[model samples]
Target: MPQSSAQVTAAEISRIAGVTRATVSNWRRRHEDFPAPAGGTDSSPLYDLETVRTWLASRGHASAATPSEELRTMLRLRAQSGGSGTSEGLLLVVLAAASHSAEELTAATRLPDTEVVDRAQRDAESAADAVPATGPVRFDTADAAVLRALYACVRDEGGQAALGVLAERELEDSAASGAYRTPAPLADLLAGLIPGSPSRVLDPACGSGTLLAAAARRGARELCGQDALPVQALRSAVSLTLTEPEASVTVRAADSLRADAFPGLVADAVLCNPPYGVRDWGHDELAYDPRWAYGVPARAESELAWVQHALAHLAPGGYAALLLPPATAGRASGRRVRAELVRSGALRAVIALPAGASVPLHVGLQVWVLQRPEPGGPERKSVLFVDTAADGPAGPPAGFGGTTPPARTRGTARSASVDWPGVTARALGAWRAFMENPDAFEGEPGVAHAVGVVDLLDDVVDLTPARLVRASRAEVDPAELSARVDATRGDLVKAAKSLARAAGHEDWSAAGASAREWRTATASDLSRGGALTLLRTVPDSVRTRAHAAGGEEGRPETRAVITGSDIATGSGPTGEPTGLYDGTAPVIAVGDVLVRAIANEGGPMARVAGEEDAGALPGPHVHLFRPDPARLDAWFLAGFLGAEENIAGASTGSTVLTVSPGRLRVPLLPLEEQRRYGEAFRHVHALRAEARRATALAEETARLLAGGLTGGQLLPSREAAEVRGQGGDSPH
Candidate 1:
């Protein structure tokens, strides 16, 4: 029964339900069953404590309350169903306003200013007594109108579109304030792994509530989110209310690791993507905590601590999904915890997600799906392992959806898109099938495998998916290998022939003795030649800006924004351009020599701009030299810039060396010779283009071969011959 001694006010109800004062009054008048007055007149009519308790417990309301009353009750029920306590009530008001805006509410509700303030204060005071209370007050004291405006905007806009706006305002502010939000797609996938329908879900380290929001969307009614950062708490509260108006979201702004907010509470499912490799996570205090049933996590295994926390909150048969770095799988410091989890049969499946999916992008991340080991649960014989690093749809150029290409020796970060929908469907499908029939689920070749527990108890419980997926045997046909070798040899021979032909064509070495090496004329000297005018004026960066401004290749309207780094990296415009707003810097008309003011101490640098790139201003990162239009053709300067000798003369410095304009040296070759060199430079340019095209073709060929070979659709000719040689023997 509601406590009669507690004399709760209408304002108290508003604070508890997170709506305005008028909403509470309307509920009392329109709904016959709303708590009856236990004391005083209409202005100060008291609510029967028991009646209030019953109202709170009934979860009942007519479908046709006034529009304003319906909205208030919707917010109230959402908070209640989610098991979110009173703190979130203020958030409800903000969400209410955001749903339609305070201005609209003020205009529509027509409640007096004193009434709104009095009711809000009373509600705030009453809510303080409610359990699990701690959010929305920050907004209660601030602009309630702004909160309403945000809700109205989001309601008019779609959820995803709202996120874009929120990202710039709330997300950007939070990011700058030092809290990082996990990408949305990854959070959705991770949360999707939790088993069954959950009445309540918790994210111990819920940063911005991505996982919790996903859980609520998936039909979870009760949501509890906690984060150490205040901004995270605020952002999450706003986000959760916006998404699941019926979900009760209780968010606390405190360190989950240190404070232990919901000490004795349990949830049906726990979804978390905690901070990775945190060095200081309250190890000493939690060392003997009863939650460490699997094993006490070590100092280095912060993820293990989060795992234990998740497990602690899970009811019997509840599931927990954790997104963890791959390092946690085989790290020795947490061997016992890993072993305990496996032996106890709590670990269900481990799947590796593609790289470049998150920060520390080079490292492949794994999602762990764990079921709390129940006393009477059935025994598990195997764990499902999926290697999706290379299994999904095609990705970016030069790589197969992970950090480094499988063919590369060194690890480096690379950009690629994962077939997110495809990957998630495949994984979730496999998991669903496995749950239906564990032993019946056979391993897919190079895709997923259900390895027996005994097999996994090797020297190291190394759960890297790559180590488990067996590589298909090479089906090299002898004739095919021979043909490939022949083709490579032919290319090599052609290169050799070209070397020989060029070697005989010119002998600068033989002529060196006859013509004493003249005093080396610096690039600066040749640049100042009567025929060649220096074009090193525009900074290198501007060229890139202009090039980028030039829309895509076919889009003439696209302007190019050039920069010095563009020339250095050989990258074209990224397709976006920034205008030169600041006054005229250095204009590059055409035929300019763009020099690297900062060059590698012992490396070659500098390139001459072509006529096509003229008229663009160089960014501040480069020095441009405009060639004289009458004396020297731009191609001649470009040829000189291409030469190694000219580059070496201009370079300066030992460590962080920079090339100075005065250090540039150029050969005083006759105009005819310069023109001849220019012709050769054009040929070299064409050859380089051909080489790049060949490289691209070769890469595509390798990818096709890899795909066909792995899919068992292709076999080498030698393998066919071997089968033929064996005469009807199965080529197993």
Candidate 2:
């Protein structure tokens, strides 16, 4: 007899699998060899339990693990063919029996063998409702071990190296978003800033346990982390477990602010990367908290409150390292806290990391390393301030640029070149030297300086990075700087001139002088005519990644995922990308005008290709518009789509900006005019590419120069560049 429909969704599989209902959705992008539908077409497939297990087994290459072995036994009783009441009846009986067998196995694994056989016989009899529809299947235990090892290896290596292991299962989940985990190198540097090994390390609002994990790696045993989100807790727990299995870790799921889970818990070290510019944080509840020995936190002093909380958790002589928004240093609301902290010598050093180190990408963050005031500690005198911001002119890398790359196929994370090793080494070395003998540690010009507390209490009370780092060589010739700027400007102007001459046969000389009225249509209208197509609607199976660019390595490879909040802002994906799709296979063809489907105004927009961008797909968050070459010129469509008219009209959503494809309209200009427009587009792309390359080169130059100068690799000289050139001529 076949099992009944009641056999499918059993609690046993749901519990041990630790998989969510959403993970079961094989909607589209990956999961190529998913189970054949028990009853439905490819468009709406639904697999029976036995078939799903079988399919899962096959992918694992037949492993003799507990689940795989049990699955084979269950498959033997599934319905062979047709909707026989026998098969249905048998399936239900088998499931009920299987449930009993599971409980027995759990107990038997810890009991005698005789009892196991007795339980197996009882289960077989009860499962008489099940029939042998399929033959027996077996797997080797060694095979399952190999699979586990492979998975572990890839995760340890990185996403690039893990592609093979990840290929089998989809990874377009939130944890796998383009958000770069803070490099362990930088984390170690921050962790080393603490004087010695702390008995307990607490990371409030820890994201994925990066800093805590790093602390553990550096020999800290007791680790504790807390976050506001359950997902973050889960991810952090998993990551921490994977990184430091021997170390004790306690991860709590609660807002660090509203609910103080570790209240009154003092630690040797407290590390945090708190939320920025968060107005909704519970300031009122914590107003009278005893942690505010530094000062009472004003309404706008949310960061100060966090600082105090970290300090409260610090034992005597313990230290706290916090990554905070720069505004907190000089913000009026928190001035008292800053004053008291510095005056008491609880504040140790303030280091300014380069821009794009973390979020608030435009405004570089400051690392405030503070020590708990000890009863009779060595009387503190001077405070150290290291400003490494404006350290470089870094931006996104080749593969994931805001604009398409020249050789599109060879894209890699932009931060691959960011010298994290050099940065970390320099910071750690300086810190280590200072710790060894504070008096002997002298500031290197343009890098680090130690100033007395009295000197810092000036009128401004400002701790801006620019004010701390000594000035570099004064500006080069203004004429030379202006010439470089003019050269760039001239190239852009020339490209515009070429575009005018090429588009609509407009005279190159007259394009700037003439103004003419013309008929136009919305991009939405043009798309409706089959003149273009948008590949924004992703199927359920496809996985995508979205991340913001930043970290130690300037601009890391990332995709901007949309959230519900994003949807409210404008027309775009409302949340983070959730699945994986083939990057190269699903290529966005040339002439596709890719715009952020959702964003506030000044949202980024770019054309699909330049003469160089071949065989590349738009990363997530972008909506690709493919105009029919027969009807519309790609470049012409790009220009029109990018214009304010199309952007504003297509835009939708409240908090975020979004545009329905049906609503975007464009000009139905003549074919010749469209071709001319296309030519202009090509020139514009080239100019943009040149500009981006120039910017990258400049940034690279700046980073190398900063590291060299600050690390004492380059000696001070009036003409540093000239000195470097002359040194290159000498032999070692």
List TM-scores for all candidates, in order: 0.49, 0.45
Instruction: List the lowest-lDDT window of 10 residues for candidate 1.
Output: 402-411
Candidate no. 1 TM-score: 0.49
* lDDT tens per residue, model 2, 124-215: 34533222122222222212222222222222222222221221122222222322245444576678788777868999877667789768
Candidate that scores best on lDDT: 1
lDDT of each: 0.57, 0.53
- List the candidate 1 regions with Cα displacement exceeding 4 Å: 1-93, 99-178, 391-415, 471-704, 707-732
Runs of candidate 2 with Cα error greater than 4 angstroms are: 1-181, 360-362, 391-417, 471-732
Q: Find the number of clashing residue pairs for candidate 1.
A: 69
lDDT of 2: 0.53
Q: Which ten residues in a row have the lowest lDDT in candidate 2?
A: 401-410
| Distance from true location, Cα of 124 in model 1, Å | 9.4
lDDT of 1 by residue, 529-577 (tens): 5544544332122232344466522222234545544454333321112
